[model samples]
Target: MQQHRCGGGALAFCALTVAGVMAVTAGCSGGSGAGDASGRGERLRAEAAGAGGSAETLRRAADVLAAAGSAEMRTSMETSAGGTRVTIRGRGAYDFRRQLGRVTVVLPKDAAGEEGHRPITELLAPGALYMKNRGAGVPDEKWVRVDTTALEDGNLVTGGVTDPMAAAELLRSARDVTYVGETELAGVTVHHYRGTAHLGRAAGGASARSRGALAAAAKGFSADAVPFDAYLDEDGRLRKVRHRFSFASDGPAVEVVSTMLLYGFGVPVAVRLPAGGDIYTGLIQQGRTGEGGR
Candidate 1:
């Protein structure tokens, strides 16, 4: 539909398929910026005593989320290659207990400067990813279903939106965790922690729903250690988390930084799985991944 720049390797496949459609059309390149500092200095000092937490605390992030039941989520994924950078963003609600969520992913504008592609609606469930507006020849009314366990990056870096629940579950393997400091997110005070997690270990400890996918990711990525930064509220609920993942392709490895922000705890998230007939089972014209045809 537009002048698409489908690069080479895994990133290429992502571009030719989901990533390309979801890549940001325009935005200034820079950090997300720090939270407000209005009164955090005093608050940070007041909470300094309890700010340093052990890795065990970070490992329990998912459990804390499960207790919260659900939350509204915003996701941002950024990557750079050949000096050009692009970002993909998503927002929606999730039911942690049920391991289900819905996200609307926005892509950049096309060469004509108009909206490049329709926002992709993604359904995130236990082990499957359902997408509408996946545009590669399928009718607009049909949805594409992909088994998360079968994806190379376990759908973490695929679908252009990281699953919020899976992202929290991944912290179960937190190692070498250090308390960075206390910070405020959207006015809520949170403790910041940084660390590296081992995918194999996380897979072993992850819930049954996410185990297979994480295991697949462990084998697919070049390294098992994934670096991350996590922020938790006083009640232990995850306020935000950022994960850096490397996907090795035919060319240089593509680095993907996925950030998830959670808020509006206990939000109602109603999602219905698609019926069989609504799924598009035809070939998708995938370029290099052999993931095209059914």
Candidate 2:
């Protein structure tokens, strides 16, 4: 997430967790660059009595995604309401062995026009989050190094929202899952599955401390199942994922939806930890906020 800020509040926009990072990472540009519902797919369950959808198949698919180790991911999303729409695109690569990864999120070329195209880059290494300068009083040239467990702006904390373990957490927790069939995604034959996860409930069930920001996002989510779609390749690895849901009226009226693509399993990804020079010191407050480069 490039320029707005970092903290629990901005986790939805910047953190590299699942959806947090599966989509690693959105400037949460939050759809400023997204447009039209054309690319925004219709509800998966709304389509048909899925020919290939089954619980066992979905479970195996989840296993494959979790076991993929290191892979490349591409994510896109659109949020729409009141005749307005916001779209986002992001991509990331990770070397799970070293627990290292990087994600970049940007808007459509045309939508970014003269706004200077806000770009958010996040590096997930061992100790901290390497963030880009978001014009938040910090040096705008180098990345800001913030400890993963540190508190931001007195009360806001980064929490586990950016934790890399989130990837496996996503696969293992999905419920009411069903397989939707197979199709070519980015030219590769893939299998699709749909399900929902109550992130709020899950957050509370375990020690998944999201603090205020996460709690708030979870509150806006309803008990109703949020639609989800997953795509798996022949090797049973995850190739794509999509999540669709609507936030509460007090929140953004737009339906919140995100799509993710995965690939390059087992490849090595180089992640460099930022040193003291990379740390931002003055006024530390700033907020900011990809797609598949797979």
- Tens digits of per-residue lDDT, candidate 2, 1-294, equal 332331212233232211222233322212111122233123223332555334445445444444667777665655554444446565677665555678776654333123545676777654456667433355666776655433221111132223333333344446787666657655555557777755554344322332332234354444335556766555655566666655444323435466655666666667776677866665444322222210
Task: Give me the runs in candidate 1 sitting further than 4 Å from their true place.
Answer: 1-13, 16-53, 110-115, 285-294
Q: What is the lDDT of every predicted structure here?
A: 0.72, 0.47
Backbone clashes per model, in order?
3, 26
lDDT of 1: 0.72
Instruction: For model 1, give the 10-residue run with minimal summed lDDT.
Output: 24-33
Q: TM-scores for all candidates?
A: 0.82, 0.61
TM-score of 1: 0.82
Best by lDDT, which number?
1
**Candidate 1 local Cα displacement, residue 292, angstroms:** 12
Query: RMSD to the native, candidate 2?
Result: 10.5
